[model samples]
Target: MRALTPALAVFALAAVASCSGAPDEDIPRRICGTKISPEITRPLIGRTGAFNEYSRLDNKSAQTAPCDLLLDEKPVMSFRFAWSSDQVDPMKYADAESTDSVSNLIEPRRTRDRYKSVVGDDGAMATVACEKAGESHFTLTMKLPDATKPDTQLRGDIEKFMTAYMNATVKEFGCRSR
Candidate 1:
C-alpha cells in the first residue's frame, strides 16, 4: 500500500490548496473611473469574495457623486464627493451627524494646507478649496460600514487610501484652486 499512500497524500495536498481562501484577483484597481493603487485598497477589501463597484460620478458638472464597493453583493464600503460653498471640517461634520461608528477622528499631519481631513476607525473625510470647480470647496468621504481591521491599523489605512483617492479624484475632475 506504499504507492497508494503517496497518491492519497498528493490528493490531500491538492484538496487543501483548493480550499485555502486567497485574495480575490478580480478586485477593481479603480473606483468611479479614477485609478488607484491596488496595494492601498486590498487591505480594506478583504480576501476571497467577488467585488463589484456601483458608481454615479458626474465628472462634467454634477455637484455630488457617490460610489459603493460591494463584496459578494453586500455593500462593504461607500464613497461620496460633493461640492460646497464653504470649507467643511470633517471632525465637526462627524460630531454634528452624531456618527457613533466613527471614533477617534484625527486630522492627518501630512496633508497640504488647503486640504482639511480626518481619519477614524471606520471612515475618512476631507475637504479642499477648489475655486475652479462647481463650488468653492470639494469634499470627499469614505465610509467603511463593514470593516474588520483593528482600530489603529484601520485608521491608518483609511487615511492613506483617502489621501490617494482624494488626489486622484481632484486631478481627474480638474478641480483647481487657481
Candidate 2:
C-alpha cells in the first residue's frame, strides 16, 4: 500500500502536465521529431463537414487551416501532417474523418459505394474522400517523390532522376479487399 501511493502520485503529475490546456506549440510534440506549425494547422486541418460556424477544439483529431474567403469563413479541406515513426515505417496518412471508415475507403467507387479519392498537384500528395453522410473529407500526405524507379535496372531512368523523383506515390488507391 505504501509503495502504491508514490506511484499514483507520479502518474497524477504526468497527466496534469500533459493536460494543461496549453496551445499545441506549448505542448510537447507527439513523436518522431514531429513538430506542429499553427500557421498551417488552424482549428481543424482535415475536417469536411457542414460548418455553420467555427470554434476552438471543434475538431481536434483532424488537421485543418483557417480561412477568411469569399465563399465562407470556414475550415479549408486539407490533411493532417505526415507521421514519422521508427517502430512503423514513416508513412503518410489522412486524419481519420467523422464520416469515413476503413471499409469505405478500400471499396470500389460505385454509385452504391461510398468513397472516392483524388490525387492532386505533385508538390504534395493529396486525397479527397467523400462518404454517404454527405460529408466530404480531405487528406494530404507529404511527397517523397525521389523514391520510385523505373522497371529497367540498367536503364538510365533510375540513374538520371532517382534522387530527384518522389518515392511517395500518390497513386489512386484502387478498391481491393485485402
- Using lDDT as the measure, the top candidate is 1
Candidate 1: tens digits of C-alpha lDDT, residues 83-160 = 888777666665424554232333323334346877767777788888644478887878887876677767777878
TM-score of each: 0.75, 0.18
* Model 1 TM: 0.75
- Collision count of model 2: 15
Query: What do the candidate models score in CA lDDT, each in turn?
Result: 0.72, 0.27
Question: Residue by residue across 20-132, what tens digits does model 2's lDDT show?
Answer: 43344532221111233432322222222333322222222332332111103442321233212111111122122314332121111211112122221211223333121
RMSD of 2: 18.5
* Best model per TM-score: 1
